[model samples]
Target: MKFRHLRNEKGISLLEAMVAFIIFSFGLIGLAPMFSLSIESNVIARDNSFASNLIKETIEEYQGVGSLPSLPFEETEDILWTKPTLSGESTSSESASRTNIFSRTISLEDNSTDASIPNGVVQINVNISWLNLYNKQKNLSSTSYLIES
Candidate 1:
């Protein structure tokens, strides 16, 4: 009697398994574009970080000088950055080289003439621009104040 009952019971057929597999594959295929998007976002974020750092360093360099730069001054230059290897070691011959060039502009403004601003105060503006991985133009800007001692 038990054997007869067991024979009446049915298991999942091969066709059902194949259908489930197809459904799962379609789901994975839908997610394929997300991987590329994530990588692109990461590259953009890295470039932005580098640009911000360059602006910060330029501001600090000007601030640390013994004499303040002349007001209404403007200068632009190209910045070169080299990518570091994954091993964190420098090899002269076996180095993999990747370089990025960023354009930076610095301008100074005299704010002492304005009644709202205190005397002997200068405004510093720094702008950094770069072409992203997608060949798109992106830029960042920063402003700071310097007081004459």
Candidate 2:
């Protein structure tokens, strides 16, 4: 009968450790651009959502009136929201005057289309414009027809 004993075994070598580190660093570098793109997409999406909500609210308000305003009327206004004071208390009337990042314009035109369609129809145009995080201009427009019932 013969017996053999095994010596000490070494762990990972320095070269293997360096290779793993290089792979990890490259992976992170590749993901860096993806993270930036994701952030930009998120900002654009949020801005678009806010604009859509504003347009919907304006339309609803006009619909509730059940009657169109004077023909060829246009109204432009800056969006404003409450700003909290340093004391963490409610906002005052003056504080409410602070403008937000968005601006909306509502334009109403009276007229119809081709021969089939009748006249006296009102066309409502809602334009929303804002500056994005990258200092680029962005705009969204919504159009709707207010037909008499």
Candidate 3:
């Protein structure tokens, strides 16, 4: 009778510990994906910020050129392919390619870079868009005035 009681008590502790371990393992598994997603999102945001700054700088340069380009609107490609395009219009996909976080459209008010719109100011629009891991789309944009030289 004494041996039987001891055996029962020993098994009870083992079973409890096993159950707890299983529950803990499940919780950890659930949290893993969340952690990964957060990391990816952070990376995406950083890349997009860099893209924005580059486009903004270009807009400023064009405006300072005294006006938008006459014919092609300055279709010149950047040194780095940090600007993505589905049409792949650049000389090489490597020269004007950026992360998928942005869909940029740089345009002057009248698509004219030859002269300031009015009041000695030019319009610059920068649009940036991204899709997170969850397949949800999001975007941010900014507009500014550039002075014609």
Candidate 4:
């Protein structure tokens, strides 16, 4: 019977471990921008969702009544459609606070010119604009047609 002596081998060298760490760091660096972009996209999506809800609610309010005013009217948080104004202009009507970042504007256009629709039909256009975290201007708009009942 012959006995053989086994030598101990190093599991990992310091150089190998450092190289692995460097490679992992590079991978993380490559993914860093994607993470930042994902956060930015999430914020933009949230703002867009809020704007969409605002527009929908405004349209529903008018549609719920099944009636639209003959003249152009604007509605905001502070001012209602019932308020009489010299011109159909509104400022930051969607949000009550003046310090709000978003500015919502509603405009109405008479669509009676379109012979296809009814005589008392009007087109409602809602625009929402804001400055994003990046200080860039972002805008969302929606249009709906309403007929006087």
Candidate 5:
């Protein structure tokens, strides 16, 4: 009696299985573009993070030098930052192949002109600009105040 009942049960036909497969494939196809978008977003985020860190490090270096040159100074230069390979080796070829060269600008201004600030205060500005994976220019800036003891 149990065998007869099991035989009577209806299973999904080939048509139903094919329809389900088609639906799943379409869903995957719809999600394909999102993968590329996600990768692009990640690259942009990474570049932004690197640029921000560069600005911070440059500012800190300037502040570490207890004394700075005459105020109202401005300088700009192109910086090539390189990273080591998996073997912890950095070669000229690797550096040259990298497209992360950034343009940096460092400026210092005497803050004494501002009536709201004291006479011994100085303003430091560091700006970093770079091109992202898409060849779009992006910029980051940091400002700091230093006081003469």
Candidate 6:
């Protein structure tokens, strides 16, 4: 009988390693956008929540004073805690209104279908705008109603 010696190959082939790397890269590429979208959604939600709190606090303050504070109020002004601070020069709106208001009011004027609703209804709008990490301007607005009973 002739003695035969067999040599075993151990370790991945170059072609196999390359194929694995390519597959992994494809998966990462597919997953990257999903991760990005999730992060953006979280950021928007957080901003909206912060804005909502601001609006709610302002509303509560107005209720206590029984009048809405003007657009700008000094820190030493009465009911200063309820005042809304306009941030960023670019977001300032030029819309003007002449209500001849006997009392200070920051409530929204509802012009949509006023068919017998509750009295003394004030609209609360939470507006939040931010410059995202991607250098894009993002804004969100949420509306709610509050009536002093």
Q: List all candidate RMSDs to the true structure.
A: 4.3, 6.4, 8.4, 10.6, 4.6, 11.8
Best by TM-score: 5
CA displacement after TM-score superposition, residue 69 of candidate 6 (Å)? 8.5
Q: Residues 51-141, candidate 4: write the lDDT tens digits.
A: 7887888778777875566556765442222213346556448334323356778876674444555577777778877766677888888
Q: Rank the candidates by TM-score, best first.
A: 5, 1, 2, 4, 3, 6
Tens digit of lDDT per residue, candidate 3, span 82-143? 44445646646555234344455565554344454565555766665556445577555677
Clashing pairs in 6: 68-104
Worst 10 residues of 2 by lDDT: 111-120
- In candidate 1, stretches whose alpha carbon ends up further than 4 angstroms from where it belongs are 1-11, 87-97, 112-118
lDDT for predicted candidate 1 compared with the true structure: 0.84
Residue 109 in model 4: shift from native, Å? 4.0
- Where model 3 places Cα greater than 4 Å from the true spot, the runs are 1-12, 59-73, 76-116, 126-142
For candidate 5, report its TM-score. Answer: 0.78
Evaluated against the true structure, the overall lDDT of model 5 is 0.81
Q: Model 1 reaches what TM-score against the true structure?
A: 0.77
Q: Write the per-residue lDDT of candidate 6 for residues 1-149, one digit (tens) a residue.
A: 99888665788889999999999999999999999899879865654555556556655665576664442222211121222335653324532221111111233533233434355665555444444445566554556665634
Arranged by lDDT with the best first, the candidates are: 1, 5, 2, 4, 3, 6
lDDT of 6: 0.51
Q: Candidate 2 on 1-149: residue-level lDDT in tens?
A: 88777665678878999999999999999999999899889867877888899999987778777677777789999986333456655466556343347889998776533333358567778999987766788899998877755
Give the Cα lDDT of each candidate. 0.84, 0.77, 0.60, 0.70, 0.81, 0.51
Q: Count of backbone clashes for each model? A: 0, 0, 6, 2, 0, 1
lDDT of 3: 0.60
Residue 71 displacement in candidate 2 (angstroms): 1.5
Worst 10 residues of 1 by lDDT: 1-10
